[model samples]
Target: MSLKSFGAKIFASYIRKKIDKWASQPEATQQKVFRELIEKGKNTKFGQDHDFKNIKTYKDFTQKVPIRDYEELRFYVDKMVAGEVDVLWPGKPLYYAKTSGTTSGAKYIPLTKDSMPAHINAARNAILCYIDETGNAKFVDGKMIFLQGSPEMDEKNGVKLGRLSGIVAHYVPAYLQKNRMPSWKTNCIEDWETKVDAIVEETIHEDMSVISGIPSWVQMYFERLQQKTGKKVGELFPNFNLFIYGGVHYEPYRAKFENLIGRRVASIELYPASEGFFAFQDKQNEKGMLLQLDSGMFYEFIRSDEFFEENPKRLTIGDVEKGVNYVIIVSTNAGLWGYNMGDTIQFTSLKPYRVIVSGRIKHYISAFGEHVIGKEVEEAMQEAMRSTKARISEFTVAPQITPENDELPYHEWFIEFEEEPENMDEFHRILEKTLQEQNSYYFDLIEGKILQPLKITTIPRGGFNHYMKSIGKLGGQFKLARLSNDRKIAEVLEENLRKYNK
Candidate 1:
């Protein structure tokens, strides 16, 4: 490794030490540290000079800044796109991270130098915590493969700015960065075929230790690797130790991945978006421990019960009670004072502030008033897949309401299997039993015969391809909407269900 790269690794090591020290502190001390950061943020030029002067205290901050959705940020993004000054972040945003939302169309989130550090630090700390937990620093010594988005930098006017992943790649230790798939110079946004092909070619012969990316993309990449090498991932990349996945839940894909890799890969979950890296799974063996960037943002949680009530109350992060589901709201360094991420999460423990991501606030199917969230659905699906010994590539649930009949709405499942089951009826029976066992609401509804029987529709090998093609998004970035608990997602699934099932 070059001297510069060596220096970067040393610097990263220093950051890791600081994080470890911070993690070892008492919960009260951590809260103090967070408060200090918020105070510092309030004093920033952009903070005081902007609308943050009114947000002196946590309560004031939450009250004054109403919760904003992505639609509210669209105008600001348009201004940024048009080269307007002082809009989203403090400085001119380097590049916009293009992502889609449940309700909205394509969203362009601004990524600035100030905000980028949070994402980089969160990701780095996640890795460090993993190493500390697993005692696997030797693994870090090997080449790390990041299955990331297109590496191309966007150019506006004369200034060239890299994508969020590209900017993040800049912060990675230079020594390890050299071994990245697609090399930083490749045009990631050119086309899906070109990008996937490049990734396949570059990763075929590398000694990869840590492999990281979204589960969907990584699954596809692993399949391609198998095809190229004429061997499964375990035979091809025998040295891989850690499998870091984010952008979606890992449980559904866990068994299949383990079967292909021939070993139990250490998995880490990251809750990140174009806006920021909100939380990460601290412990590799346990569920996610959400170390809130208290310094970066003030948080609020709307109680699930209250949300369904006529008049809802918003609970501050301090007021959150353990074991109840709540929607998250944030007041961040970015111009977004209070933004609702539209995600529902429950605090598993309050002392260390660990949380279980329940589902999207909007991603639930309540046709029969059962109030089932994504978490319940996911758990059900996973249990079903396990029991039936069926490998699912992708799946979605849609509520079926019959106008002519008074029977409660039923759930229709569109499953894309890795291999067809010989006994399809047995598969369906196992799935229904799993769902009934996993969710009390589903169980009660099914036992009462309020809902119709669970309908299973198995698709051809390229079912997802047809769905993606119909939506004009057939590529690495496209992912199946896991939780269709809302109307918009239901509508999309309805259209696709008609196309595939009919």
Candidate 2:
């Protein structure tokens, strides 16, 4: 190897060693490490400027700071845009991660040096743990394809850093960096057509071991790959061993992926946001383990049941228990203190911190003007899937209000099935029964006949593609939204209803 490549190999080796050491630590030791980072953050310039200097412990830290969302961070971002040296973090942010601010409009989130490590380490651990679980470290011998957003640097900010994908590409050791598909310089998230073409062209002759990115985008790529190769993805990329996915739930898209790929691809669920990488799938059979970045942030959890209670209970990482749903809060080195990310999680176990993403706290659907949370929808869907004995490929639920019928509201489903059900009406009844039983409001409405019969729209193959195209969103990162159980569902459902009405 050349001298530069040799140096990169050494650096990559060092990173691997550090990651293994961190992952092998006992839960208690890991917590201590986290506490130390939180303490150090309290002393840093960011802490003082953000009112964290006086906070000595996690309790004091969370109490003094109020929970903040992306909108509040936008205030800090505006200052950064004006060239403020320090606002949220100690130094000027290297660049911002542009995220779809679904509810709050567009948001440019600060990505600082201290914060970058957390994101990188979380992602690295996800990969390492996947290898450990599958006993497939040798799969790394082949090239990995990360179907990600373009790396074009934001010219307006006078920042050289590309989006998160680009920024991560730059930080990876040079040797492995060269192995990246569609070289960073050429990939642009906005230029989807060209980027996708480039990715397909570049990987045509390469041996692929792992593929990672948003499931929607990866699915799109595989569809294109099928057309181009005239062969399924399995035939074209037989060596691919793992599928690392995040950004959205995989349940809806799982079977489709398995069908296209022709083998069971090991999956790793990653929790990444523009702000930082928070958790990842740590074991093979178990759900994702919340690997606390004890060195990056102090963690807190607000019990899901108590989230709206008169005096809701908030628990530290130390206080979390098995099987309870919680909203994750964090105080990170990058200057975010007591920030609530709005994602809901349920602990599978307490000993090792295993948790499954329940849903977004803010994202839910209830059409009868009753609150229907993500957990409710998940349970109802699970029951529906079981009752019908039908494998759901993808689905989204919304409330429909019939015109001229003021008192009647109905639930509408846009469903993609693995195989056509023998009796469509029976399938709908099973789903309706499941929903009514799972959600009390639906049950009451159905009994009173105040609610219209549930409507079902069976989508044609590639229906998600049409949906993604309609929104001008690339399939890779977008998710099917279960809009509020009220009028919001009507707006979201309208588009899908129009597309899949047949």
Candidate 3:
């Protein structure tokens, strides 16, 4: 047996064993987890403020700690950055995950020595679970090329700061590091164009077996590799059998991704964010990821329909029902109290509990009360793309409610396409019809003439790239908001589209 292949088998076996233990647990395990996190932080200021000492059950915890977004959480984070120990998490945060903010300019989410493993372990288990399912241990023996941002970190107050991907890069096991391509020096290059080129140059001929990154950047890397090698991805990296992706939904890009690879590869979907690594795709046949119940975070759910109500009902793990969209509220070991992750999810299964991200609370368009979301638009667009034989590179959507010069209100789509459909009118018709089918409210608006037919404006090839770079958010976990209630992003892309015209 080859030495590296032997090692792959051993590692894969270990991961599968761990996952077996995690999956075999009872639903009551979630309650035990909630108690554990509360006890872990009971001495911290946040814990005390929330009356964690006396909080014994889900109802008590909910009544004590309220749902909060970044704006409310920033004060404690600033205290952490200014050398406060046990402000949020006990002691200082191990790292601060810095992400771009539209209004606040920057957001710093905490990670602790204890809670950091939740992020790392969920990622490792996902690949391991894939190996278990397919018996593909040889992937472990070959190199992996992760298209991540610069690992270089800055300091805030006293805490180290970088993108979550960048921060996590520092902790990749030494054994894996040897087989990972793109030297840290190359990965540290701040400009994405320069970094991707170096990555292509570094790994084009290696024994690459696994690839991981967001879909957009992965597309860029694949394009660059094809340009350099003049061959399909499968031809370039014959050992490649696995693709790990997160940060955004993959269904919209699935067709394009498959075409780029030139062959089918196993795909694992993960639900990871700056706040925590919440879930992982345990089985390919499953519609949603299995929530990581033991991962140092207690989960709570509030029905999205009632989230805007004066008082929303908080549902515990046992109380949640399948097919209802819920805004996730979490209390984590890192000491975030009743933190609203801002991501919306819906359970596809409740026996062991699995969820798919439905949308973002802030990332929606309901300007005319149509109340549309990311998952709805993405699915509609994918269906339209398929029916029309079109391929979009990137896109964003917003409601055009306020008529300018007495124009009709509509939903505007700013899209960049790798292959524009021959029938633009039919392509648009499908988009409008699919959306009407996805959201009844949207359909009613169209039926009532409250909304004009949706409009599409073609963005020049590099319009999204220009916008991301313009905002200093070109890489890592940053992605263009797919839908918004406002037209700010549409305006930027419209101006970029003008450049092509000129």
Candidate 1: residue 235 lDDT (0-100): 76
| TM-scores, each model vs. reference | 0.85, 0.84, 0.96
* Local lDDT at 324 for model 3: 80
Q: How accurate is candidate 3 locally (lDDT)?
A: 0.85
Best-fitting candidate, scored by TM-score: 3
Error of 3 at 118 (Å): 1.2
Better of 2 and 3 by lDDT: 3
Residue 184, candidate 1: alpha-carbon lDDT: 64
After best superposition, candidate 1 residue 110: deviation in angstroms?
Answer: 2.8
Q: Which regions of candidate 2 deviate over 4 angstroms?
A: 1-51, 102-104, 155-162, 309-311, 367-370, 375-393, 401-407, 417-419, 433-453, 460-463, 485-502
Model 3 scores worst on lDDT over the 10 consecutive residues at 19-28
The digit string of per-residue lDDT tens for model 2 on 1-502 reads 3454344345455655665565555355546755665555554444565566565665675566667777765565677667766566665776777667766766676677777887777777667655544545655566877777666666435644445766676566454665556566556546565667778888877888788888767876776787788887878888887888887777656666777787677788887876667778777777666655454766778986577676576677667777766888776666665677788888886656667777777766544545556666656666666555566556667667664647466766777676666777787777677767766776777788877767876766666555656666653445666545555534544566675675
Q: Identify the runs in model 3 with alpha carbons over 4 angstroms from their true place.
A: 1-7, 10-14, 24-26, 403-405
Q: Over the stretch 4-27, how does candidate 1's per-residue lDDT look in tens digits?
A: 445545655675567556445534
Residue 106's lDDT in candidate 2: 61
Which of 1 and 3 is ahead in TM-score? 3
How far in Å is the alpha carbon of 485 misplaced in model 2? 4.1
